[model samples]
Target: MKPVRYTGLTIAWWLVGTPVSAIDVQHSSLVELEAAYAYKTGSWQKQEIVWRPEWVTRFDSGARLTVIGEGRFDAKDKLDPGRPDQPFRAQNTETVFPSDHIDLELREFYLDHYAGDAFVRLGKQQIVWGQADGLRVLDVINPLSYREFILPDVEHRRIPLWSALTEIPLETWTAQLVWIPDATVTESTLPGATYSLIPDPFGEGRLQVNRPDSLADSDFGLKLSTFQRGWDLSLNYLYHTIDDPLIRIDASGQQVLADYNRSHLVGGTASKPFGDLTLRSEVGLESKNRFQDSLTGEIINTEVGSYVIGLDYSGFSDWFISAQFFQTYRFTGTHDNGSSKEQVTVLIRHDAMNNALILEALGIYDLNNKDSLIQLEAEYSVSTNVVLRAGADLFFGDQSGTFGQFQEASRLSTGFTFSF
Candidate 1:
């Protein structure tokens, strides 16, 4: 049977087809232009422009609707080298391709309604649940896109889903429930793309992906949150298919098979502030997790626990600093991929020139692999509606490490955004 495909255009058309002649409407738009130059290849890696338009309508009964659409053009399509034959299965159904260099998509469309002390939101939207910066522990409600290899902001990398979400206030505590029917998984760069993760030692190989496409495969989660005595805390639980695929080679070693598996996740987060510093932490345990053996090509099933601790300081004027430590441990699994992994990240930001200019730096280091990534950027406000940005991404370590594998892909970039 053919796989079931969900398209954003279907929901968009349905929304537009509804009659709303007596509602209040508000509209806004933004344009972003960016380019990057690869020092290793000595060529332009990307030259892209994006336009986003948004609309919001409010009814007298307190119901609201939001719609956002995005259009992109790439003159140098190095980052998204079109996979004509396969077409990158994850987002193909929701996105439209006008040409080799142009694409259009419905970014987000949702409705917000308040019923007494409870809130309901239904449609294609993003749900975030973590406090860690540049790291994901309990934020698995939505899958991610790795087209730029985690270089873009979180808002740009996350792929929204069609879901039902509601929040209920119970005294001093709030409970959130989410039901996601969209089966879109994480999107990895294709073979010919700049940041492709698949290795082709022998030659270019075929990749076959089996995605879940039934309502029975839907995902659901629950979260309870409360604040007491200057502390913020939440408990989260989710039962869903893991977004990352487990890749294995066929017996013939000519084709790669990628499949998804289900897991039960129990996690929690806590944060508190003291004077000029804030402490934040998150912990999660996955009941069933799968990892591929590097040497034998075997898939190992095991339980995994991961945690992160972060601290943010803002004592100094016009400056903010934050640091985080993250670790993952496998309870019972083959030792080929290591039993435990450690990582650290740091971020520093400064505002200058009377808040017209800003400088920021972020660093991520893998303790086990001894590889690291450093990012530095500066932004200048040209006016109230325009902002200019420049940055550099540097990678250091061996090719076998995570960040080290992208050493050659490091580059300098500049961009601008205009909003109105």
Candidate 2:
């Protein structure tokens, strides 16, 4: 069977067939409905309306179940037989595609059980780590979908991992262990998506993938955390597959093969509050790192170290301010030629009108490459159970840099959510 078919079956089994022993049940449930639309500027790069429905239930025994899904429809995806440039696009049925014109997804379906000081969670779920915004340091469990870029919350963008998680509380610290039985790989971009990172991006290609779905390819992670002297600290170790693919192009340069690298990560994080300000920092080292060579499309193995430090303050006029510095160093990578790259980000948010209106702004500056991205947004509470949101994404800098590659993808967006 094809990988996409296998993935669909896996998700179906987890959503409807995963079982656990349980006792008497007292039921509580919630349902949420959400819709959104976005329009790309200048060109028909993107236009779409997305619908999402989420539901969750809890039993008296402290067992919880959740189901979340989404469907998307794009204006340009409709057929226009008269126009040469306007073509009919088929909806995507695969769960993990690089991009989507029309698509349906069961984003998360999970069961959680707790007893005494121990807990177990099974099925597909997102496990978030680290405290930095817009940058990843120790948060490597789930692959992120960047189709919508960083406009969405990290939780919304994080691809759920199908795994089992166990947690236990000891006298001095809490321990968590995660086991992924069959890992799925997510790609960076699709054929005609709005954004492109590669120079002269290809419009058509085949991706031969090497994924961790076999028994020998499963992944594992362990974390220990504790609070001491007003500081929260955690130590982590992971034996997992990298989310980003290492690409190797054929001699023809039109066909590409991507593979996952088994890697080990050792990381630590700490956070503390000083009056109205909170400080956070995390650092990690990845041994046996792998990445694709931009020019040659060859995969190379190396070692890398990454770190992030952040500060958040909320002492001024109901405004929240956050600033962070992030850096990554290549110890032995073929790419970057053993050089380091750095970036800084600042975020500001404020609420007014009795907490009915919220304003937010975020800016990211690449100190090394001089590229930047800025996002501005506002959300208003139309009603007690409904919210209206609008935002814009702007990119600036050199074409070779990260944010600058999407200079033509900047766009405005709006959304609405209703909960019951």
Best by TM-score: 1
User: Runs in model 1 with CA error above 4 Å?
Assistant: 1-22, 83-93, 201-205, 251-253
Give model 2's TM-score versus the native structure: 0.83
Taken over the whole model, the C-alpha lDDT of each candidate is 0.84, 0.69
Highest lDDT: give the candidate number: 1
On the 0 to 100 scale, the lDDT of residue 177 in model 1 is: 96
Report the lDDT tens digits of candidate 1 across residue range 1-420. Answer: 012124443443344455544379999999999999989879888899999999998865576778888899999887767534332334433576678888777878787877788898878899999778878889988888788898888898888888889999999999999998878888777677888876554455577777877367889999999998998999999998888888777757677777888999999999999999999999999888888877776778988899999999999999999999999899976747679999999999999999999999999999999999999999999999999999999889999998998898899999999999
Q: How does each model score on TM-score?
A: 0.93, 0.83
Clashes of each: 0, 0
Clashes of 2: 0
lDDT of 1: 0.84
lDDT of 2 by residue, 1-420 (tens): 154335544544453344633344333323333333334344554455656667666654466766677666555642111111111111121352224355556666677767567887776678877766769988987777665666568877777766778899989999999987656654344444555222223545444455555347777899999999999999999888777776566657666566677889999999999998999999999887776667665666788899999999999987999999999987755643445889999999999999999999999999877999999989999998778878788888887778887776677766666655
Model 1 earns a TM-score of 0.93
